[model samples]
Target: MTEKISIESNVMDERRTSGELEIKIFNQSDKTRTALKKLALWWGLSLISVLLPVVHFVLVPLFFFLGFFFAWKGFKSEGQVLDGKTTCPHCGNNIKVGKGELNWPVTEICQSCARVVRMEKKEA
Candidate 1:
Protein backbone atom coordinates (compact mmCIF):
# COMPACT_ATOMS: atom_id res chain seq x y z
CA MET A 1 0.00 0.00 0.00
CA THR A 2 1.21 3.52 -0.77
CA GLU A 3 1.55 6.06 2.06
CA LYS A 4 -0.51 9.23 1.78
CA ILE A 5 0.24 12.63 3.26
CA SER A 6 -1.82 15.81 3.70
CA ILE A 7 -0.58 19.36 3.98
CA GLU A 8 -2.10 22.73 4.70
CA SER A 9 -0.90 26.24 3.94
CA ASN A 10 -2.03 29.79 4.76
CA VAL A 11 -0.79 31.35 1.57
CA MET A 12 -2.15 34.72 0.51
CA ASP A 13 -0.96 37.49 -1.76
CA GLU A 14 1.81 39.46 -0.06
CA ARG A 15 1.23 42.48 -2.25
CA ARG A 16 -1.99 43.16 -0.34
CA THR A 17 -1.39 45.08 2.84
CA SER A 18 -2.67 43.61 6.06
CA GLY A 19 -4.23 46.75 7.53
CA GLU A 20 -5.49 48.48 4.42
CA LEU A 21 -8.48 47.25 2.54
CA GLU A 22 -7.96 46.94 -1.19
CA ILE A 23 -9.94 49.16 -3.52
CA LYS A 24 -10.08 49.91 -7.23
CA ILE A 25 -10.34 53.38 -8.66
CA PHE A 26 -11.22 55.32 -11.81
CA ASN A 27 -10.91 54.50 -15.47
CA GLN A 28 -10.45 57.10 -18.19
CA SER A 29 -14.18 57.70 -18.66
CA ASP A 30 -14.94 57.51 -14.97
CA LYS A 31 -12.13 59.88 -14.17
CA THR A 32 -13.49 62.48 -16.57
CA ARG A 33 -17.03 62.20 -15.25
CA THR A 34 -15.83 62.46 -11.68
CA ALA A 35 -13.78 65.58 -12.41
CA LEU A 36 -16.65 67.36 -14.11
CA LYS A 37 -19.21 66.38 -11.49
CA LYS A 38 -17.02 67.55 -8.65
CA LEU A 39 -16.32 70.84 -10.40
CA ALA A 40 -20.00 71.49 -11.04
CA LEU A 41 -21.00 70.55 -7.52
CA TRP A 42 -18.24 72.59 -5.93
CA TRP A 43 -19.10 75.69 -7.94
CA GLY A 44 -22.81 75.33 -7.32
CA LEU A 45 -22.33 74.75 -3.62
CA SER A 46 -19.92 77.66 -3.37
CA LEU A 47 -22.52 79.94 -4.84
CA ILE A 48 -25.16 78.78 -2.41
CA SER A 49 -22.71 79.00 0.48
CA VAL A 50 -21.86 82.55 -0.40
CA LEU A 51 -25.30 83.76 -1.38
CA LEU A 52 -27.08 82.67 1.78
CA PRO A 53 -25.57 83.25 5.19
CA VAL A 54 -27.89 81.27 7.43
CA VAL A 55 -28.46 78.53 4.92
CA HIS A 56 -24.81 78.51 4.08
CA PHE A 57 -23.92 77.33 7.56
CA VAL A 58 -26.13 74.32 7.11
CA LEU A 59 -25.83 73.81 3.35
CA VAL A 60 -22.10 74.23 3.30
CA PRO A 61 -21.56 71.38 5.67
CA LEU A 62 -24.11 69.33 3.82
CA PHE A 63 -22.38 69.95 0.53
CA PHE A 64 -19.01 69.37 2.08
CA PHE A 65 -20.10 65.94 3.23
CA LEU A 66 -21.72 65.33 -0.11
CA GLY A 67 -18.60 66.39 -1.92
CA PHE A 68 -16.47 64.16 0.24
CA PHE A 69 -18.78 61.27 -0.34
CA PHE A 70 -18.72 61.75 -4.07
CA ALA A 71 -15.01 62.23 -4.20
CA TRP A 72 -14.36 59.11 -2.19
CA LYS A 73 -16.95 57.26 -4.18
CA GLY A 74 -15.52 58.47 -7.46
CA PHE A 75 -12.22 56.95 -6.57
CA LYS A 76 -13.83 53.53 -6.20
CA SER A 77 -16.25 53.59 -9.11
CA GLU A 78 -13.89 52.55 -11.85
CA GLY A 79 -15.33 49.50 -13.58
CA GLN A 80 -14.13 46.75 -15.85
CA VAL A 81 -14.71 46.85 -19.56
CA LEU A 82 -18.42 46.22 -19.56
CA ASP A 83 -19.40 42.81 -20.68
CA GLY A 84 -22.98 42.10 -21.72
CA LYS A 85 -23.92 42.06 -18.06
CA THR A 86 -24.66 44.40 -15.21
CA THR A 87 -27.43 44.56 -12.65
CA CYS A 88 -29.57 47.37 -11.33
CA PRO A 89 -28.88 47.92 -7.65
CA HIS A 90 -32.32 49.41 -7.20
CA CYS A 91 -34.62 47.55 -9.53
CA GLY A 92 -32.65 44.35 -10.06
CA ASN A 93 -32.92 44.75 -13.79
CA ASN A 94 -30.02 43.57 -15.88
CA ILE A 95 -28.06 46.29 -17.62
CA LYS A 96 -27.01 45.82 -21.20
CA VAL A 97 -23.32 45.93 -21.93
CA GLY A 98 -21.83 49.04 -23.47
CA LYS A 99 -18.74 51.22 -23.46
CA GLY A 100 -18.40 54.32 -21.32
CA GLU A 101 -17.44 57.81 -22.48
CA LEU A 102 -17.00 60.06 -19.45
CA ASN A 103 -20.53 59.58 -18.15
CA TRP A 104 -19.96 56.74 -15.69
CA PRO A 105 -21.70 58.34 -12.72
CA VAL A 106 -24.82 58.95 -14.76
CA THR A 107 -24.65 56.31 -17.46
CA GLU A 108 -24.41 53.51 -14.90
CA ILE A 109 -27.42 54.73 -12.97
CA CYS A 110 -29.75 51.94 -12.01
CA GLN A 111 -32.99 52.23 -13.90
CA SER A 112 -34.98 50.95 -10.93
CA CYS A 113 -33.97 53.10 -7.96
CA ALA A 114 -32.01 55.47 -10.12
CA ARG A 115 -29.15 54.84 -7.76
CA VAL A 116 -25.58 54.20 -8.76
CA VAL A 117 -24.32 50.69 -8.13
CA ARG A 118 -20.86 49.29 -7.61
CA MET A 119 -18.70 48.64 -10.64
CA GLU A 120 -16.10 45.94 -10.94
CA LYS A 121 -12.49 46.89 -11.46
CA LYS A 122 -10.50 45.29 -14.22
CA GLU A 123 -8.43 43.77 -11.47
CA ALA A 124 -11.38 42.66 -9.37
Candidate 2:
Protein backbone atom coordinates (compact mmCIF):
# COMPACT_ATOMS: atom_id res chain seq x y z
CA MET A 1 0.00 0.00 0.00
CA THR A 2 1.31 3.45 -0.91
CA GLU A 3 0.72 6.56 1.16
CA LYS A 4 0.93 10.22 0.28
CA ILE A 5 2.05 12.96 2.64
CA SER A 6 1.60 16.54 1.59
CA ILE A 7 4.61 18.79 1.94
CA GLU A 8 3.64 22.41 2.44
CA SER A 9 5.62 24.96 0.53
CA ASN A 10 5.26 28.40 -0.96
CA VAL A 11 3.20 27.30 -3.91
CA MET A 12 1.56 23.89 -3.47
CA ASP A 13 1.51 20.64 -1.58
CA GLU A 14 3.20 17.87 -3.52
CA ARG A 15 2.46 14.22 -2.88
CA ARG A 16 2.03 10.92 -4.67
CA THR A 17 0.11 7.82 -3.61
CA SER A 18 0.54 4.69 -5.68
CA GLY A 19 1.68 1.09 -5.68
CA GLU A 20 5.42 0.92 -6.31
CA LEU A 21 6.24 -0.06 -9.85
CA GLU A 22 9.48 -0.36 -11.78
CA ILE A 23 8.47 1.07 -15.14
CA LYS A 24 7.05 4.41 -14.00
CA ILE A 25 10.09 6.54 -13.45
CA PHE A 26 9.05 10.02 -12.40
CA ASN A 27 10.48 13.52 -12.18
CA GLN A 28 14.26 13.77 -12.09
CA SER A 29 16.23 16.69 -10.69
CA ASP A 30 19.51 18.18 -11.93
CA LYS A 31 19.91 21.59 -10.33
CA THR A 32 21.51 20.73 -6.99
CA ARG A 33 24.16 18.64 -8.71
CA THR A 34 24.97 21.35 -11.18
CA ALA A 35 25.33 23.84 -8.32
CA LEU A 36 27.62 21.47 -6.42
CA LYS A 37 29.83 21.02 -9.44
CA LYS A 38 30.13 24.73 -9.93
CA LEU A 39 30.90 25.23 -6.27
CA ALA A 40 33.55 22.50 -6.28
CA LEU A 41 35.32 23.95 -9.25
CA TRP A 42 35.51 27.40 -7.70
CA TRP A 43 36.55 26.17 -4.27
CA GLY A 44 39.11 23.70 -5.60
CA LEU A 45 41.23 26.55 -6.84
CA SER A 46 40.48 29.00 -4.04
CA LEU A 47 41.32 26.57 -1.25
CA ILE A 48 45.02 27.03 -1.82
CA SER A 49 44.78 30.61 -0.72
CA VAL A 50 43.74 29.55 2.76
CA LEU A 51 46.49 26.93 3.11
CA LEU A 52 49.13 29.59 3.37
CA PRO A 53 49.67 30.41 7.05
CA VAL A 54 52.60 32.77 6.65
CA VAL A 55 52.03 35.91 8.76
CA HIS A 56 48.31 35.35 8.71
CA PHE A 57 46.16 33.17 10.95
CA VAL A 58 43.01 34.24 9.13
CA LEU A 59 43.77 32.06 6.11
CA VAL A 60 42.72 28.78 7.71
CA PRO A 61 39.44 30.01 9.15
CA LEU A 62 38.67 32.08 6.07
CA PHE A 63 39.31 29.05 3.93
CA PHE A 64 36.81 26.98 5.90
CA PHE A 65 34.22 29.73 5.93
CA LEU A 66 34.42 30.45 2.24
CA GLY A 67 34.46 26.77 1.41
CA PHE A 68 31.28 26.02 3.29
CA PHE A 69 29.64 29.25 2.22
CA PHE A 70 30.23 28.49 -1.42
CA ALA A 71 29.00 24.95 -1.02
CA TRP A 72 25.78 26.06 0.64
CA LYS A 73 25.20 28.69 -1.99
CA GLY A 74 25.77 26.19 -4.76
CA PHE A 75 23.34 23.61 -3.47
CA LYS A 76 20.71 26.21 -2.71
CA SER A 77 20.88 27.81 -6.15
CA GLU A 78 19.69 24.84 -8.16
CA GLY A 79 16.88 22.23 -7.91
CA GLN A 80 14.11 24.83 -7.69
CA VAL A 81 11.53 24.17 -10.36
CA LEU A 82 11.70 26.81 -13.01
CA ASP A 83 8.68 28.85 -14.01
CA GLY A 84 6.70 26.01 -15.58
CA LYS A 85 3.57 27.96 -16.50
CA THR A 86 0.84 26.99 -18.93
CA THR A 87 -2.91 27.07 -19.32
CA CYS A 88 -5.05 24.43 -17.68
CA PRO A 89 -7.18 23.04 -20.47
CA HIS A 90 -10.00 22.02 -18.15
CA CYS A 91 -10.18 25.09 -15.94
CA GLY A 92 -8.89 27.61 -18.45
CA ASN A 93 -6.67 29.03 -15.71
CA ASN A 94 -2.93 29.52 -15.30
CA ILE A 95 -0.76 26.63 -14.17
CA LYS A 96 2.89 26.38 -13.29
CA VAL A 97 4.86 23.18 -13.02
CA GLY A 98 6.59 22.75 -9.68
CA LYS A 99 8.58 19.71 -10.76
CA GLY A 100 9.18 17.12 -13.48
CA GLU A 101 10.54 17.17 -16.99
CA LEU A 102 8.21 17.64 -19.89
CA ASN A 103 9.02 14.59 -21.94
CA TRP A 104 5.72 13.72 -23.62
CA PRO A 105 4.19 17.00 -24.71
CA VAL A 106 0.60 15.80 -24.76
CA THR A 107 0.64 13.38 -21.85
CA GLU A 108 1.17 15.73 -18.91
CA ILE A 109 -2.09 16.39 -17.13
CA CYS A 110 -2.90 18.38 -14.02
CA GLN A 111 -3.81 16.38 -10.96
CA SER A 112 -6.04 19.04 -9.40
CA CYS A 113 -8.41 19.53 -12.34
CA ALA A 114 -7.55 16.76 -14.80
CA ARG A 115 -6.60 19.49 -17.23
CA VAL A 116 -4.29 18.57 -20.07
CA VAL A 117 -1.69 21.08 -21.16
CA ARG A 118 1.32 21.10 -23.41
CA MET A 119 4.57 20.43 -21.64
CA GLU A 120 6.68 23.49 -21.22
CA LYS A 121 9.84 22.70 -23.17
CA LYS A 122 13.15 22.92 -21.36
CA GLU A 123 16.73 22.00 -22.26
CA ALA A 124 18.23 19.26 -20.15
Candidate 3:
Protein backbone atom coordinates (compact mmCIF):
# COMPACT_ATOMS: atom_id res chain seq x y z
CA MET A 1 0.00 0.00 0.00
CA THR A 2 0.90 3.68 -0.06
CA GLU A 3 2.18 5.66 2.87
CA LYS A 4 2.86 9.33 3.47
CA ILE A 5 6.02 10.12 5.34
CA SER A 6 7.85 13.19 6.55
CA ILE A 7 11.24 13.80 5.07
CA GLU A 8 14.14 16.19 5.24
CA SER A 9 16.21 17.49 2.34
CA ASN A 10 19.73 18.70 2.57
CA VAL A 11 21.25 21.02 0.02
CA MET A 12 24.92 21.32 -0.84
CA ASP A 13 24.97 24.59 1.02
CA GLU A 14 24.05 22.77 4.27
CA ARG A 15 20.52 24.10 4.25
CA ARG A 16 17.86 21.63 5.40
CA THR A 17 14.21 21.65 4.37
CA SER A 18 11.25 19.52 5.44
CA GLY A 19 8.67 17.95 3.17
CA GLU A 20 6.46 14.93 2.60
CA LEU A 21 7.04 11.87 0.46
CA GLU A 22 4.73 9.16 -0.83
CA ILE A 23 5.89 5.58 -0.99
CA LYS A 24 4.44 2.22 -1.96
CA ILE A 25 5.08 -0.83 0.20
CA PHE A 26 4.52 -4.14 -1.47
CA ASN A 27 2.91 -7.04 0.33
CA GLN A 28 3.84 -10.68 -0.24
CA SER A 29 1.31 -11.07 -3.03
CA ASP A 30 2.37 -7.80 -4.62
CA LYS A 31 5.99 -8.88 -4.57
CA THR A 32 5.11 -12.19 -6.14
CA ARG A 33 3.10 -10.46 -8.86
CA THR A 34 5.93 -8.07 -9.61
CA ALA A 35 8.44 -10.92 -9.78
CA LEU A 36 6.28 -12.88 -12.17
CA LYS A 37 5.77 -9.86 -14.41
CA LYS A 38 9.49 -9.18 -14.56
CA LEU A 39 10.25 -12.80 -15.29
CA ALA A 40 7.68 -12.90 -18.07
CA LEU A 41 9.03 -9.74 -19.66
CA TRP A 42 12.63 -10.91 -19.71
CA TRP A 43 11.72 -14.43 -20.85
CA GLY A 44 9.60 -12.97 -23.61
CA LEU A 45 12.56 -10.89 -24.76
CA SER A 46 14.67 -14.02 -24.83
CA LEU A 47 12.09 -15.77 -26.96
CA ILE A 48 12.04 -12.87 -29.38
CA SER A 49 15.84 -12.85 -29.53
CA VAL A 50 15.74 -16.48 -30.75
CA LEU A 51 14.51 -15.09 -34.10
CA LEU A 52 17.79 -13.20 -34.57
CA PRO A 53 20.53 -15.00 -36.49
CA VAL A 54 23.87 -15.03 -34.73
CA VAL A 55 22.78 -12.62 -31.99
CA HIS A 56 20.39 -15.21 -30.62
CA PHE A 57 23.31 -17.25 -29.36
CA VAL A 58 24.29 -14.41 -27.05
CA LEU A 59 21.01 -12.55 -26.40
CA VAL A 60 18.89 -15.61 -25.79
CA PRO A 61 21.15 -16.92 -23.08
CA LEU A 62 21.67 -13.47 -21.60
CA PHE A 63 17.97 -12.76 -21.39
CA PHE A 64 17.19 -16.22 -20.06
CA PHE A 65 19.63 -15.85 -17.18
CA LEU A 66 18.73 -12.24 -16.56
CA GLY A 67 15.07 -13.18 -16.18
CA PHE A 68 15.74 -15.28 -13.09
CA PHE A 69 18.07 -12.68 -11.64
CA PHE A 70 15.59 -9.87 -12.10
CA ALA A 71 12.71 -11.95 -10.79
CA TRP A 72 14.63 -12.74 -7.66
CA LYS A 73 15.45 -9.09 -7.21
CA GLY A 74 11.85 -8.09 -7.71
CA PHE A 75 10.72 -10.65 -5.18
CA LYS A 76 13.12 -9.27 -2.65
CA SER A 77 12.05 -5.67 -3.11
CA GLU A 78 10.11 -4.32 -0.14
CA GLY A 79 8.79 -1.05 -1.46
CA GLN A 80 9.30 1.88 -3.80
CA VAL A 81 8.98 5.59 -3.77
CA LEU A 82 5.99 6.73 -5.77
CA ASP A 83 6.70 10.47 -5.79
CA GLY A 84 7.56 13.33 -3.50
CA LYS A 85 7.50 17.09 -3.44
CA THR A 86 10.12 18.98 -1.52
CA THR A 87 11.42 22.50 -1.40
CA CYS A 88 14.80 23.14 -2.95
CA PRO A 89 16.90 24.48 -0.14
CA HIS A 90 19.06 26.41 -2.55
CA CYS A 91 16.44 28.03 -4.77
CA GLY A 92 13.42 27.87 -2.43
CA ASN A 93 11.43 26.40 -5.30
CA ASN A 94 9.29 23.28 -5.18
CA ILE A 95 11.06 20.23 -6.51
CA LYS A 96 9.40 17.03 -7.69
CA VAL A 97 11.10 13.76 -6.86
CA GLY A 98 10.54 10.84 -9.19
CA LYS A 99 9.83 7.18 -8.48
CA GLY A 100 12.63 4.87 -7.41
CA GLU A 101 13.36 1.72 -5.43
CA LEU A 102 12.86 2.15 -1.72
CA ASN A 103 16.10 3.10 -0.04
CA TRP A 104 17.16 5.38 2.73
CA PRO A 105 18.67 8.78 2.02
CA VAL A 106 17.39 9.24 -1.50
CA THR A 107 19.30 11.74 -3.62
CA GLU A 108 17.71 13.82 -6.35
CA ILE A 109 18.55 16.84 -8.46
CA CYS A 110 16.45 19.95 -8.19
CA GLN A 111 14.83 20.76 -11.54
CA SER A 112 14.29 24.42 -10.69
CA CYS A 113 17.85 25.46 -9.92
CA ALA A 114 19.73 22.29 -10.91
CA ARG A 115 21.05 21.74 -7.43
CA VAL A 116 21.58 18.37 -5.80
CA VAL A 117 19.31 17.50 -2.90
CA ARG A 118 19.71 14.63 -0.46
CA MET A 119 16.54 13.33 1.09
CA GLU A 120 16.05 11.17 4.17
CA LYS A 121 13.35 10.20 6.57
CA LYS A 122 12.71 12.90 9.15
CA GLU A 123 13.53 11.81 12.66
CA ALA A 124 11.01 12.26 15.42
Best by lDDT: 3
Q: Can you list the residue pairs that collide in candidate 1?
A: none
Cα lDDT, model 2, residue 117:
46
29-109 in candidate 2: lDDT tens per residue? 344565466666656655666556673366655555676776665454423332344444455455545553223332346
Candidate 1 residues 41-124, lDDT tens each? 865786678678678877877776777676656555544232234555445566544544223322345456665444432331
Clashes, model 1: 0
Ranking of predictions according to lDDT: 3, 1, 2
Report the C-alpha lDDT of model 3 over 1-124, residue by residue, as the tens digit.
7999999999856689998889999999988998999999999999999999999999999999999998998888777889998998888899888998776677888888887898889998
lDDT of each: 0.47, 0.42, 0.89
Compare candidates 2 and 3 on TM-score and give the better one. 3
RMSD of each: 14.9, 12.7, 2.2
TM-score of each: 0.38, 0.29, 0.82
Instruction: Mark the 10 consecutive residues where model 3 has the least summed lDDT.
Output: 100-109
lDDT for model 2: 0.42
Arrange candidates, best TM-score first: 3, 1, 2
Instruction: Let me know the TM-score candidate 2 reaches against the reference structure.
Output: 0.29
Off by over 4 Å in 2: 1-29, 42-47, 78-124
